[model samples]
Target: MQQAGIPTGSTRPFGYKDDKRTLEPAEAAALRKTVERILTGASPRAIAADCNKQGLTTTRGNGWSKETVKQVLRNPRICGYRSRKVREFNPETGTESVRVEPVLDDDGEPVKGQWSSIISVTDWEAVTEIIGRNPEPGDAYNARKYLGSGILRCDKNGCGSHLRAQKAPASRKKPEGFFYYTCPDKRSGYGCGGVRISGPETDEALKMLVISKHEEEAEDRQATGVPEEWEGENELARIREDIDDWTERREQRLVSKERFFAFLAKSEATERRLVNERNEWRRPVLRAKGEPIDLRGEWGDLDFVEKRAYVEKTLLTVLVASAIRLGGPVRDRLTPIYRGED
Candidate 1:
């Protein structure tokens, strides 16, 4: 007999109806028990092994396989939720079944509409979160393009720079229709006595060690791995630790209670400092690193919070020096990192 309208090499006629369907209540109950067993630490492979050993057959009466076991686990029918979407192939069109799954919840969980749910809402959430990480189509994976746009600093002293975007001719034949970034201040801005060079020229001039810092950060994250959530937890733990230590010292009479209260009064100040530091570490280091540039689409596409993140990542320091010389030495004085001028 054929299952899911696929030819099973069996002598089953098309459109032949069978009273014994696999999605019945009894099958659902059995499937639920099987799912519960698996969730309680039984591996899918092991469960498949046990099912095959017991001479149990899938809907097609075929021997159990690990893949089938996984499909069953993911199926929602066992949990009394019917799957809304079922595959129905058009024999004439030779088209595959289309997905009709609905957004299960606001968190993007899949809801049961036709087949019963074998997994709980929580387990479903975990699986969805894992799967969601797989990058989708149209997803460009480069950090440097946008982050380094305005932030890359020119190491040249007097020319301590801000990025300048200008269109200049690349060659005689082609009008180089590309964004060329350079140190605006270094090239010919205030106090910058250094020679103003094009972005492509300066890229060649910059030291490899300085340029590679951003690339190293990106590569290291890919290699060792970093979780997005851990950063917040780490900061929270540090804050709590500091608070606890202070409290303990005061309670144990090691530090006077008055001193402890005084410190408490400054808690908001400490919090502001910590918040600034958090923003700093997460900030992108913008410098030419011979890395692939990744401008993340248009600015209008980005939301406000993301725009702020982009600003924090780029736009390093604004150096203040004496006067710009026509062709003299640039000072190396480092000024305050611009946090946006008032």
Candidate 2:
């Protein structure tokens, strides 16, 4: 049964079908998108809030939470690998412990499962790096209170540091402190230290840009289509089989040690190239249906967290130039660089 490659559990995985070998299209796409978001520095807490706001539920029909999202992100099953819990008894300590580990093949590689992967194995490992990170302190995982706090960048000549949200010193017009975006001199390391703008004004201007850009992309995406299955799958399998065959031949003394090693290196290099192409070809399709036509209308009711998530999904980074004057339109010193830009 261990080598049969059949999923033993009755419950279907989050993004797969009942058989556990077929993808649930919508759920799989969502999982892929979530992985991409997490890899791009979206906090799990913020993602959970956004999921709940959209009335989305898990495969078990349970409401999303920070832990649940993290659990899914750390699961290797999403990337087409099988894992099992092995119970061990320590005679010296007289204790029993259970731990989960990925099932490996003879060559010490994780056994690939039947279900299509939502993301590449490399991406899954990258997401797992967040497991030990402190979400409160690190800029990548830290949750921002302002819409463009960490998403906006300093467009200085050689410095492209992210801007932080902070309060301005109290003044006559403002009783309390004024909120604005500024490049952190300490954090930026070598920032030019001249980029600053009103937080409220910058947020307003960026919000419009995100919505307008999203609508424009959506219009173009309607004509785009997902391609057929990647043709390189067979090529990849053949390469692996060739590797195993050569490995066996070397052990049997049919080839010289150096010759076998050189062949093995070349095989691994070709395999890597094929795997890269396969991964890029299988990127999650961006469905045009069910997406909001105008995010501006929904902007009024959204809280700060939701607004920030919306902006992150649409814009790659908003580059803010140094203010040229005392006061002007927020759009004047701002430049928006949307996602997918070269």
Candidate 3:
């Protein structure tokens, strides 16, 4: 079974039939449409919602999700490559671990699968490049309880460390306990010297701040109006030119391999940054046209992960000042730095 290029599982890829030898026409078509939509600037979240509306399900018969759609887009199997998960057992510990490894042909390239390709290699690569530019979501394994753990930054002088949420020490006044966001450096005795802020108060402050910003943006759109077009082409073109120049230099042996790779990394980072900035420009236009979300009403109902995603999308950094006095005044200490504005 290991010698064969088949996945050692019952589940087949979404665009393929259970037999794994035939293409499911409808699923294949859906995959193609998904890639096309992504290239045309539709987000994974939008695509997933559309899939659900159309009664589409994953290969495992589950509802479509952003992560699911992203996985499908990133899978090399769509290009006819064979992917397999190999499980190895350790004799000493009697433990097993599984790792995904691509099967290779005689020439050491990825093995072509028995099934027909749903998407061409070029199109698959293009889709991957576009998706790679988007910011990835935080890990869901250890989902945060407080919304501000990673997004909030300690604003103590000479120490701008990320704030972490931890359960506040139990006291006679409130034995049930509470959470607080404190500088990890201070907690670890690294000497950040930052003050801890009440988690519930910070959350409320952030919600209000987000709502206020949203309202302000709405008014601004009504007055000045959203931009008619994205002006990011020039910057993106410059970055691509730099990438090509670096590639040519590497090919011509003008730059060492290490330097070439470093230049490529920097260029790619800049490209992703510029692409995100371009997306931010489009978001306002979408909001004006009533296509994007307005989180005011649904804010309280969201879970920690959902709230974190919203905060990350809207704000770049939340600065936490020293909480000199607790309770209502703590809300005034928080300063939200919105994206594109900073």
Stretches of candidate 1 above 4 Å error?
A: 1-26, 80-342
Best by TM-score: 2
For model 3 the TM-score comes to 0.47
The per-model lDDT (C-alpha) reads: 0.44, 0.73, 0.72
| TM-score of every prediction relative to native | 0.25, 0.56, 0.47
Which of the predicted structures, 1 or 3, would earn the higher TM-score when compared with the native? 3
Candidate 1 lDDT by residue in tens digits, 94-182: 86653323335432334443332444544332332322312233323455443234444555654555555456666634345544454
Model 2 lowest lDDT segment of ten: 133-142
Q: Hey, what RMSD does candidate 2 come out at?
A: 7.7
lDDT of 3 by residue, 20-72 (tens): 76899999999988876665445676678779879999988799887778877
lDDT per residue, candidate 2, 1-342, as tens digits?
A: 444445777678888888888899988888887877665445676677778888889878899887678767766778877766667777997877654456787776887776788888767766665443222222234367778876899988887988888787765366465688988785547566678889888888988898788667666666676555568878899999999999999889999999999999999999979876664444333233224334555566556666777788778888999878777778988888877788
CA error at residue 104 for candidate 3, angstroms: 3.7
Candidate scoring better on TM-score of 2 and 3: 2
> Residue 116, candidate 2: how far off, in angstroms?
12
